[model samples]
Target: GAGVSQSPSNKVTEKGKDVELRCDPISGHTALYWYRQSLGQGLEFLIYFQGNSAPDKSGLPSDRFSAERTGGSVSTLTIQRTQQEDSAVYLCASSFMPQGSGNTIYFGEGSWLTVV
Candidate 1:
């Protein structure tokens, strides 16, 4: 993909249902990230995967949220037992190595999840 691609641009799920969001990053990007933005709130880091190393899961909100990147390209974010408070726009981004100093990270349009 030329840019970060996210699926299910809009989703409305009932409370307690499970949902899965997918992202396909730009080719050759070594770093992938998942973030959540609640209404009027700043971006909240969720997970990050860099190269072949272990993923950084420190920012995930709770046990119900989990993510994984396969083959360093596509990634999936799963939410179990979704609650109304879990509603948010999930953004996926990817960047080349050396994220610092002039590196440009591309973000997807985002998957908007509305837990009803």
Candidate 2:
């Protein structure tokens, strides 16, 4: 894809259900990141993957939240036993290099997950 691509742009789920959001980074980009934004709040970092090194999952809020990057191109974020507090917009971004390297990061429109 020309830019970061995210799936299921909008989702509404019952509390306690599981949800999976997908992201496809721009071709050739080696770094991908997942972030969450609650209503009226700024983006919160969730997970980050760079090349084949260990993923930085330090941002995950709880054991219920997890993510994985496949073949270093596509990524998925899973929220298990979702709670109403989990309602938020999940944004995915990709960059040619690590943010510290001062590269441009491109973001997807984000998947809006509503737990009711």
Candidate 3:
């Protein structure tokens, strides 16, 4: 089975622009999550969707960031009015269930965003 994959591995954009990043999760996995890891920072959860449950969006940093999952699989994260502070690694992961505190999550290499 194919693992999760992301595109553009690297992206550079100017301030105040909008960018869209894509993620393809593994097949048959019912849970998908998006996270961000800025330089020297920890992984911060962004949004997550599992089957028919409402998405958890508590970790989205600001109104500029938003995401959606279609068909319970592929997802895309969009940042409007991008800022330099948004530069970071956007990672996508998927699993069979909501991972517990210690459960492992397989991660994509991540899309590196650089705001100039």
Candidate 4:
């Protein structure tokens, strides 16, 4: 099947607006991850979902950031009362194997969000 896929490739909104980003991971991949990248900045881990549970949520930037996965296939990341600093490219990835294993993770073309 295909690799990870994210929706709303581009999003621009005024501050205080909320945004939801969706991700469709590869069929059977099981391990899903979210990352954020800002202009001229490196990717920062946001969250990781193993199966339907997120054991390492410490990566989330703030309380306004949240995510959930259903049926171990799809995930959504939501930012509430967005701020201009929240502007960045959101990326999703999936790996057939767990982290630290030899499996290669596949990344989707990031969804760009800009808060004005």
TM-scores across all candidates? 0.94, 0.96, 0.91, 0.97
Q: How well is each residue in 1-116 modelled by candidate 4, as lDDT tens digits?
A: 57678998999989999999999999999899999999999999999999999999999989999999999999999999999999999999999978789789999999999999
Output the number of the lDDT-best candidate: 4
Root-mean-square deviation of each candidate, in angstroms?
A: 1.3, 0.9, 1.7, 0.7
> Each prediction's Cα lDDT score?
0.90, 0.93, 0.88, 0.94
- CA deviation > 4 Å runs, candidate 1: 52-54
lDDT, candidate 1, 15-42, per-residue tens: 9999999999999999988999999999
**For model 1, what is the alpha-carbon lDDT of residue 6?**
99
Report how far residue 57 has shifted in candidate 3, in Å.
0.4
Q: List the residue pairs that clash in candidate 4.
A: none
Q: What is the lDDT of candidate 2?
A: 0.93
Cα lDDT for residue 85, model 1? 97
Model 3: per-residue Cα lDDT over 1-116, one tens digit each: 47889987999999999999998888877888999999999999998878634368898999999888888888889999999999999999988777875455778889999999
The order by descending lDDT is 4, 2, 1, 3
Instruction: Give the clashing residue pairs of candidate 1, or none.
Output: none
